[model samples]
Target: MARRSYKTELGCIACEDLSLLGAGKEGWLVDNPNILCAIDTHSVALANRSTILVLGWSDSDGSRLKIRPELSPIEAEYVSAIEWLVFDEIRVIVAGTSCGYMLIYSLRGDLIHKQMVYPGRVIKLRIHGTKKDLIQDTLSGELCVVTPGAIARFDGSDIQNMLLKWFEETHAHFWGLKPKRQGSEDFGNSHEKLPYQLWNVSKYGNCADAAITGIMPPPLIEVQSSQRYYCAVAIGDDAVISAFRLSEDKSRSLVGTILSKVVPATFSTISSLSKMIWRSEQTSPKKPDQKPQSFARAAPLTCLKDHPRKGEKLTLSPSGTLAAITDSLGRILLLDTKALVVVRLWKGYRDASCLFMEMLVNKDIASSSSKYYEPSKSDYCLCLAIHAPRKGIIEIWQMRTGPRLRTIPCAKGSKMLQPSHPFGASMSSSPYVPLEVFLLNGDSGQISVLNRTLDT
Candidate 1:
C-alpha cells in the first residue's frame, strides 16, 4: 500500500446527520434535517427536469420536508421511527409515528399515497424483489405488507408476527410458544403436570438468552434478478452477515452460508485470603459457589456491497461477496465467501465515530498516484470515509497506507462526540459516473460534496 493525500472543502448545509442516501436517474436526496432523524432518498420526475426527493425538517420553518405546492397537504408524521424502501424505480417512504399511521411517498417526493400503516412507530421496512413486488413494513406495533393491488395487515405486533412467520417457514416451530403443558396419569391415578413450555423442541433449546427467548421471525427477504441477495442482520449484541440465493421459481433460499459471530473471552478469579469475624452464635463456614464469568459480545453491521461478477458465491474472494458490516467500534470486516472468514479487517480505531465505504472510479487512482497500481484488484477496494471524533476530524482513506490522507475538521461544538445514535454522521455516493462523495454535517445541517480542487 502507498500513502496518499488530498484536500477538503465545505459543501451544503445538511444541518443534520442524513438518515437516507440514494441516487437515481433524477438526482439525489438527503432527508430529515435534524440530528439522527430518519431520512428518505428517492428520484422524482418533475416536468422536463429530474429532481431527487430530499426529506428533511426545515431549519427556518421547522416543518417536515414535503413536496412544494402541496396537493393533499397531508403532513406526514412518524411517531416512533421511519424507514425508506425503493423498488421498481419507485421510492416507498414509510414513517411509523404516533397514533398508528404510515405516510407513503413516491419517488417524485409526492404524497400521492397514504395509509394508516400502524398505530405506532415503524421500526423496519423491506421490499421483496420477486416478480410479485411485495412491500413488507414492520412497525413498532404491527407487521404489514403493501402490494401493487392490495395491502395485507397482520394482527398483534410486528415482532410477534415475525416470530409466528419464522416458526412456520423455517420449520423452527418452537419460536411461537406460550406457556402450556400436558399432563400424564401417575401410578395412583393422579395427574402429573409438566412444566409449561413455549417454542418448538428443535430451536427452543438452542436459544442463548432471554432476549432471544422471545420469538424473532426472519426478516422480509429479497431475491434480486442476479439469483443472489445480501442479508445483513443485527443480532443480540452481535451482527451477522449472510448471502442467499433464490430458486428458479423465485423461492428465496440460503446461499453460501457465512457466519460472523463475535466470540468474547472470559476471565475468573477467587480470593485466596481468609476472612475473620466475631459472632455470638457461631455458624458453619459456607463455601462460596465457583462459577466462571462470561462477557457478552456485539458488533454493528454498517454497510454491505456485493461483488459485480457471478460464480461461486461462498468463495468470497472469487464470486461476488455478499455484504460488508461496520460497527461503531470502527472495525471493518470483509467477508470472503469461499474462505468463509473475514478476508480483511480494516481497523481504524478500537471504536469508530462514523465510517462509510463505496466503490469509486478505478482510473482516478492511476492519474492521482504513480504507485503503479492496477485498477482491478486494488480498484475493488472501495474508498474508505471515516469520522474520527477523538480528533474532531473527518478523514478520507484513499489507499491502505500511512499518514493522514485527507482530513477535514468539523466546526467546533458539533455533535459528533455523541454516542452512535441515528443520524450522528452518514455519507453517500452519487449515482452518477466518477462517483461523488457527500458528507452530512449533522450539527450544521450542511451537505458537502468532496471534489478535487486544483492549486491556483
Candidate 2:
C-alpha cells in the first residue's frame, strides 16, 4: 500500500515580522494581541515591545489605537503586560508595564486611568466577573495580578463601577444587556463566571524560580445555586502548569488542602495531558512520597509545566474550554480545558505563533439540502493558525485534534518569512466564514490576503 500524505493549503498571510531582523533575533517578532470581548466587533489588543496597539476587526479606516503616548514615559516604564476586560456597562483594555504600573483604557482609545499596580514588572493579569471572594464590593469577578514573586487579587467591583460611570457619563450607552437568566443558550453559557471580581490574593513562583508568564480564570463552573467556583491555571519559568481553586461560597473543595500530584513517566500519553485538569479533584492521591504531585493534561501525558522545556505562552478558546501552549521547543500543545488534557500536539514549528481563527466546519449545512442539516453555530469550528516564521508558512490545525487543515506559505517556494499580524486571537460573535490566507509570489512573502472562500 502507498503511504498517505496530507495536503496543507495556502491561507492568507496577515503581516510581516520586523522583530526577526537579525540572526538569532527571533524573539523580537513576538507581537500578540490579547483579545478581550466580541460583540459588534472583535478586540485584538497586544504589545510590541513597550508599545500597546489595539485593533478592532470592524475598523474600516485602518485606524488602530496606540496606548504608548497616552500612557507615556516609555523610557521609564515599558509595557510588559496587557489584558482586556468587559462588564455589563463597559469594555476596556488593561495594561501593565516594566515599572510596575497598570493602565486602563476605554475601548475607544481613551485613557481612563493609569495607576501603579505593582512595584516591579506586572508579569500576568486577568479579571473575572463572578464573585471569587466572600467579601466583595461588586459582583464583577476579581482582578488577578501576577508579579514575579506573588499574585494579587483585587475587587473587580471597582473597575465595574468605574466602567458603569464611564458609560453613563460618555452618553454612549453601549453596555449591552446580558441574558436575563444565565446559561440560557442552547450550547450552554460556558462563560458564566466572567466579569471577574475580587476576594483573595496569593503569591507564588519565587520558590519555583519562575517568573509568571500567564494566568487564566477557570471557565464557568456552578457548584451551588448562584454559587460558582473557578480553578485557575498558571505556568511560568518551568514546564509545570499550576492549578488553583477559587470560590466565593466557601464550600468544601474537591482539591481542598491537597498539594502536588504525580503523573506517569512515559510517552503515548502526550495527548491526554489536558484531560486530567478538569477531572474531579477528589481522585486518589499518590503514595506518601514521590515526585511533585502533578496535574496531568489528559491522563498519562501529565502536565507540561516541569517537562524540561516548559511552555512560554498560552492561548485559550473563546469558550474557555481549551488552551493552546507554545513551548520553548517550538512545539504547540493543544489542551482541552474542560477535560484538562493534552488533546493534540503539533511539532516541527520554528519560531511559531498561533491564533484561533474561525472555520465553517459544515458547508453543506448552509444549503439545507441534507437531512443532517445543522445550525451554523453548531457547525462553527475553532482552528489554530500556527505561524511558522522561519519557514514563512502558517499551518492551520483543527483544535482538540491534530488535523492539518491547511499549510500556507508566506512566499512562493516558502522563501523569506512573510510577517503576519495576528488576526483576532479570539473568534467573532458574528456569523462564521471560511477564508484562505495566501503569500504573494514576490515581496519575500511580506504580503498576504484572506480570500473570501477556500477550495475544497
Candidate 3:
C-alpha cells in the first residue's frame, strides 16, 4: 500500500501561503532571483552573469519597482554564483563565472574589479563577513570560491583599496588623459586590476559543501582566537565533511585538521528513526595513543563514512554546529559538525534545496514531546526548510529530532523558478528575525510570500 501511495496534489491544499512578489521577464529568466542582498526587504538586487535586476520599494508608499542594469559587456560568460560583499565600508556585488572569473561591480552596476581566482568553473562563491555579520574572524571582505578542482580563499584588503583606485582611474580616463602606468595583467583579461591574496584548499577534490564559522576548535589546535575563532567545514567529492581551523593569516589556513564528520552505520538511519537509539556499536572510535595533528597541516581527525546515496549539496546551520547534506536518494542527514556525527536523518524528500529559518520553539510543542518521552527546548528552533520543486512544496522539519514539523504546499504556478535562501547579509541580520519566505509557483512566474509564522 505504501509503495502504491502517491502524494496529494499541492494545488488542492487550501492552506495559508506567501504573498505574490513578482513575475519573471517573459520567460527570459533562467533561474530564480539570485538575490545577493537587499538594502531592504523590498529593495533587492538580482544578478546572473550579464543580466542584472534591482528591485526597490518606494519609501512614501509601499510599491515595488524593478530596475534592470547592464552589469557586464561580455554576454558569453556564465554566472555560477553572485554575492553582496561589504568590507572596509566598501560595498559591491560580486559575480562569479563558470569560465573562472570573479567580477566585482559597484552598487550602480559599474564593473569595479575583475580577477581570475580559479582556472576551472567556480561552483560556489561564499563571501564571508558581510554587512550583517560584520564582526567575523575573517577580514572585512574575504571570500571563498569553490571550484571542482579546488577551493580558493581571496583576501578583502586589496580589493577594497582597489575599488578606490578604480574611481581614480575612471576620472583619469574621462578627461582624455592616460593613467601613469599600464598595470600588469597577470590574473584577468587586461581590465581587472585587483591585488587580492588567494588561497587554494590543496587538501580536497571537487569540494561540494563549505561554510565559515566561529565554532571552537576541538582541542586539536595549539593556537586559538581570543575574540572569535575562524574555522570552516568543507566536503568534497569524497563526502567527507572536514573541519579546519582557518588561520588569521588566511594563507596558512590552507592546512590543518580539526575533527571527524561521519556517523557509523550501526547508529545510522537504516535502523529507522522511531526505533533508533544511540548505542556503543560505532565502528570507528579514537585510537589509543593517537597523536594530534599539527596546525600547519590540513588533516581531519576522522572522516565519516559516505552515505549510500550520492550527495548533491551541503548547507550548514546558522550556528555552524550542524550540517545538512542532501543526497540523490532523497535523504537529508543532519550532521553535528563539531562531533562529526549524524544527529538525525530525514527521508522521502526528492531534489530539495535546503535553507535555515529561525523561530522560537513554543511551549505547547515542547510539552507534546512527552508522548515520545522527549522534551523540546523553548529558546529557539533550528528549522530545516526543504524546498522540493518536484513535489511543489516546502517541508519544514524540526532538527531536535527527525520530525515533520510542517508542510507548506505550493500554489498553482507552472513557471516557478528555483528555490533559494535569502542572501547571507539578510539571513545573518538577526538569527530570529521573522522572514516571509517567498515561495514561487511553477506557472506564470508568480510568487507567494509566506505571510504567517509557525508560532504555534
Give Cα-based local distance difference scores for all models: 0.31, 0.47, 0.51
- lDDT for predicted candidate 1 compared with the true structure: 0.31
Task: Give a tens-digit lDDT track for model 2, residues 1-456.
Answer: 673322232322223322222212322223233221111124345455455655443335234565553334634666666676765435677777666556677656666655544346676665434323345432334566665533455556666665565455445323445333221221121212222222222222431211111233433443334544444455555434544454444332222212221132322254246456656556557433222121112111123445566556565554456666777777777766555677787788755666566566565654455665434555656677677877777677776664877776453222211111122222332443433332322222222343222343
lDDT at 164, model 3: 69
Model 1 scores a TM of 0.38
Compute each candidate's TM-score over C-alphas: 0.38, 0.54, 0.60
- Highest TM-score: which candidate? 3
Which regions in candidate 3 have their CA more than 4 angstroms from the true location?
Answer: 1-40, 43-50, 56-77, 86-91, 130-142, 154-204, 215-230, 240-297, 305-308, 362-380, 412-436
How does candidate 3 score on lDDT? 0.51
Ten-residue stretch with the least lDDT total in model 2: 292-301
- For each predicted model, how many residue pairs clash, with residues at least 3 apart or on different chains? 43, 61, 15
- Poorest lDDT segment (10 consecutive residues) of candidate 3: 10-19
Please list the residue runs of candidate 2 whose C-alpha ends up more than 4 Å from where it truly belongs after superposition.
Answer: 1-75, 83-92, 107-110, 115-119, 124-146, 149-161, 170-227, 249-307, 366-375, 411-456
Better of 1 and 2 by TM-score: 2
